[model samples]
Target: MIADTELILNADGSIYHLNLKPEDLAHTIILVGDPERVPIVSKYFDTIEVRKGKREFITHTGMLRGKRLSVLSTGIGTDNIDIVLNEIDALINVDFTTKVLREDLRSVDIIRIGTSGSIQGNIPVGTLLASEFAVGFDTLMQFYVKSYTAAEQKLAEAVNRHFSNLSFSPYIGSANPALLKQFAMELPKGITMTAPGFYGPQGRSVRTHNMYPDLIQKANSFITKEGLYITNLEMETAGIYALSNMFGHRALSINAILASRLHEEFCANPAEVIDSAIQYVLNRI
Candidate 1:
């Protein structure tokens, strides 16, 4: 039996952070980093049936092309990803009334549509990319007991050896192969580096000094034995992939490239790029 302290729930029997019950969730979920983007993804729905939110988490469930789907926001970073993914897994797999795990466990398809910066100069602004794998600079995955596959282990070793000057070890997580094959056939795909913050963690300096000034150069030059490169930088993909694996759910991160870290360029029309990326995923999903 799970303790109340461990699996906390609201008085309304909805999952604590997400404020959603099992019925309120759909089998396919779209995760966005911004709360306002929740409605942007759902606006194309045939009919929106549920709308719920708490803090930065907002959810909308509706139908599109006779398929039921839901869009939820996780704000930013792996910390928020931890809360949103766990609460969502509990909503589908645990009985809130009984405070126990359900006999018949369920799995959901999680798709992340978010903006990111291209670490490779070849991948220019306004390009849409898919995260085949993510290298987490954050420590979120350390708390969870996970076994890395042979390929994942090899990739992690490469990243660690390349960034040996860094203080902490990085971890690797991957997208669901089934989802990758389904949606990434026509898109450019590569490894994404998930940073803990937008500024210093991602090697940006304002007033404060950056610890690893050559971080972007090292990342851009990193190549795997399999010949893959670290292509983009973002806040959530690694944690999303990690927890989705832990929960037995299918997860994919589709990124809209609005900036190029390698070339120091930002897209002028960010909204148009985001809207197009949203429509692209919607049409395929």
Candidate 2:
């Protein structure tokens, strides 16, 4: 089943979207939201094999502690994730040049190191959070053919009720369990509350009238029966987690805390916080 765009490429032997080629990548991939931040994370690399950028997507392939890795920018949202994820999967699992599904598909470990705000006051700025779960609040899931079980449906219904009462839609998502067992001990672990944005979507104070004033409280207090708390708030975790899980890939999110929604103050120096997060994940992964 070859798609029309079999070999996604640029004129100079670079990838189409990422502007990179096979030799320019490594098995371990780290995804970041901002393209400018790609080099910041890759700076710690022992040796940089390649560097390429296309539009909002930037990639740096190198070695860190002798672990071959690719640091790529997935831009700001889940929409960008769809392109990068599919292409990376095609490169690793499907053999893009030939457009053939490899008999033995190689699974690349993906880690998202991003900045986020804390819904729970306990998680203050400058702390790094690892998402054990992600509650999706985006449109990426509608693309997939879904068949939710009765139990799953009930949970979704409850989530809907909670959102409807508050007049905001909360996406239900979770991180890769395999990743949790691997690096859970390294960072402060909790379920990440994946939000759609930093504005009114997350109950941020903009120029317009916003929804529930107790949005963060509602999120923090609404715990699943098994005891899952909404710990962090970011844009793409739910989409990344959901899609990666559906495709049989492992994914984890390590968030550098920038603000506390409860306290309403962003970290004075977010650069140091994000830097610390990168080092932590690099060492752990």
Candidate 3:
């Protein structure tokens, strides 16, 4: 049994950060980065069952075409994902009343529908990019033991070799194949690089000077030994993939490209593009 300090709960017995109970969630979950986007996804539901929010976390559970699904917002970045994933796992796999794990574990499908900037020129703005693999620029997974797969290790080595001058090591993670085949078979597939932040981590500079001036160009040109290139840059997929894999959950990230770094083009109507992608995912999943 775990201590209360380890997994703090509210007075009503809801999870500390998410404020979600086991009954509030569904087996199929659509994760968004923006809290406001929660209702945007849930709007397509036939009947809304639950609507809950706390901090940047907002959850809406309902039925979509007769399938029970839950859409929850995780705000942004790997740090938030660290909290969301672990809490969701605990809600289903652990008995909060006794602070003990259940005899039988439950795994859920986590599909992240978020926006990203394309590093590759061919992938234009408004495009929907399905992450076949996610490369983490952050050190989230490094804190966990044996978090990467054999394929990921090989890809990580190649990525490190390409950006050898960088001080930190990057990790690679693959999306669940079953989920990918089910939801993203016809979509444009590529390796997504998840940055730690919106600015310098993604090679964006305002008043501050960038450590790697040619970071975006190098990332765009990076081709693995197997000839796979990095497609886009986002903030959450790698952590989602790694943590989901560790917890036995099926994870996939579907990105709506809002900007093209190589072409220097940004979507004129990003809302429409995101809505279209959300509708597309709803139709499939």
Candidate 4:
């Protein structure tokens, strides 16, 4: 049987697929998708310490405004998320580094600051969108559970029939209100759509063309009776919300709206938006 942890690399602890260890992180963490962005975030740090990596998973732990935090890259998709979330939880919750369980492990605050395109016109470029909720069109959760909640099922039924969506179904998801609310003053709040990919998954055109030409339009028009909106499109927010919630971590996604294909415009300078989010979170957290 596969166990929770098996020491392999350093021999003193479990070496996750990412190869990160207990000492490699801080309680306040920021996760980006690109390894290059790791240092971009770390540049705001007050002091530098541990730096480790394997493949696209690059890690750097440092102090920002006297607050120690770690910034790491997950490469892409829910697959990498599955690996990072579980092992990070283990590092703090389990006692594999020792022989006893460390139930009192410090809870890490995880915030994903990344770039995404706005599905709607109102959510324009050069703004930071803090995702209050994420709607997943990915099947990562399917391996864990066979059924969806009533609301999730309802969302699926609605979106599926409208767009003839398949291969993956929609799942309603949310982040920790406390965590999201903490940075409320800094970023624009919205309901983000977590699409599986940039091409067919998000209604993008290639030489072969998109099967659902109106899917993006349909998405821009969607809303629940509760007045929730899907304002932005991204790859990782849904997985982040679902896994982080399940594992008892407060998580949020701050997406820089760099492009709105509907308007055919770009952010002009998206790095400014990213800087805003990084500075805001660094201060608030």
Candidate 5:
């Protein structure tokens, strides 16, 4: 049984951060980074059932084409993902009222539909890409004991060697292959780099100076001995992949290219691009 201090609940007994209960979610879930995008995905539902919100977390449960699913927003970076993923896992696998682990574990399918910037010029703006692997530049995984597989270790080593000058090391996480096989048809598969922030971490310079000015270019050119290179840059996929894997859930990240770092281009119709990707995911699921 988890202590109250560890698994905090609201006055109504909902998860503290997500404000979700066991009955509020579905077996299959779709996660978006923006709260507004929650409705964008749920709008395709044939019948809507649950709609709840608190803070940046928003959840909508509904049926589409007779398939029941839940859409929830994680809101921006891995920091938020840390709260969302654990709470959702607790909702399903833990007996919240008793604060005890259930005999039977439940694994949910988590798909992140997000917009990203292509690190490689060839990926092109407005294109949809599925993450085969997610490289995390954030320190989220460091807080937990090691959970990386052998393949992830090799990838992390290669990334570390490539960027030896950096003070911190990056970790690598892979997407669920079953989910990837189901949805990756006609979608280009590439490794995604999940930055801690949209600014300096992603090599964007504003009022503050960038520690790695050539970060984007270096990331673009980095190729492992296995011949894998980064395809896109986003702020959430690595955390989603890592946490979902840790909690025994299947996860995938489908990206809509809104910007191109190599070409210095941004999508003219970003909303339409995201809408198209959402529809594509809806059709596949």
Candidate 6:
């Protein structure tokens, strides 16, 4: 049995951080990085039945296309992804009252519709790209025990070699094959690089300077032995993929390219681009 300290619950028995009970969750979930984006996606729902919020985690459960769905905000970064994914998994796969794992495991479909910046010059702003694979530059995977496939192993080795100048080794994670094929089969697909932060980790400069001045250039030039190149940079896809796979859930990230580091371009109408991506995902669901 899990300890109370380990599986902390609120007075009302909802998950500690998400403030969502098992009944409030839907099997199909959409994750956004901003809490405000939760309503943006839920707006298209035929009817909203549950609306819950705690800190940056906001959840909306409703029906769309005669199917039940829930959209939640995970705030930003892999750190937040770690918290949100683990808690939600526990909500589904564990018997909260008993504080034990359920006899039968359950799985959920998680789709991340978030914005990203293209590292490659060809992938321009405003394009909706699906992440087939994501390489995490963050340390979230260090604490988790993950077994990689031969393809993932090869990609990880290639990325490590290409970015040899970096202090730490990077980990590669991929979208669930079934989910990728269902929603993003026809979309442009690429490997996404998940950075830990927005400014220095993503090669952005404002008030502070980055240690690796050529981080973006290196990421742009990186290519795997199989000829896959890193296409875009974001903060959460890698963590989402890794944790979702670990928890026996399906996950996919659909990105709206809001900025281009290669061409130094930013999307003029980001709201339109995000709405388009949201509609694209909603229609498929």
How far does residue 187 in candidate 5 sit from its true spot (Å)?
Answer: 0.6
**Residue 151 lDDT (model 6):** 82
lDDT of candidate 3 vs native?
0.93
Candidate 2 vs candidate 6: which has greater TM-score? 6
lDDT of 3 by residue, 1-285 (tens): 989999999999999999998899999999999999998899899999999989999999999888999999999899999999999999889898999999999999999999999999899899998999999999998889755678988898999999998899998889999999999889999999999999999998999999998999999899876779999999999999999999999999999999999888999999999999899889987
lDDT of each: 0.94, 0.78, 0.93, 0.77, 0.92, 0.94
Model 1 residue 158 distance off true place after TM-score fit, in angstroms: 0.7
Clashing pairs in 3: none
Model 4 per-residue lDDT tens digits across residues 1-285:
234444333444546565766777788778999898898888878888988888888889988767788998988877778777776776677665454557576567889988899888877788778888788888878766534456656665666665565555677667678887787756677778877777887887877577677777888888776776679888898888887777778898888788997897888887788787777777787
- Candidate 1: 10-residue stretch with minimal lDDT: 7-16
Q: What is the alpha-carbon lDDT of model 2 when measured against the actual structure?
A: 0.78
- In terms of TM-score, how similar is model 3 to the real structure? 0.98
Model 4 residue 128 lDDT score:
76
TM-score, cand. 5 vs. native = 0.98
Superposed by TM-score, candidate 3 places the C-alpha of residue 109 at a distance from the truth, in angstroms, of 0.2
Model 5 CA RMSD to the hidden true structure, in angstroms: 0.9
Error of 4 at 8 (Å): 6.5
Lowest-lDDT window of 10 residues in candidate 4? 1-10
What is the RMSD, in Å, between candidate 1 and the native fold over all Cα?
0.8
Per-residue C-alpha lDDT of model 2 across residues 41-150, encoded as one tens digit per residue:
99999999888888898899988887899999998877888788877776677655665788997777889999998888788889988887777776777778645444
Residue 101 lDDT, candidate 2, scale 0-100: 85
Cα error of candidate 2 at position 136, Å = 1.0
Query: How close is every model to the real structure, measured as TM-score?
Result: 0.98, 0.89, 0.98, 0.88, 0.98, 0.99
Q: Is candidate 5 or candidate 6 better by lDDT?
A: 6
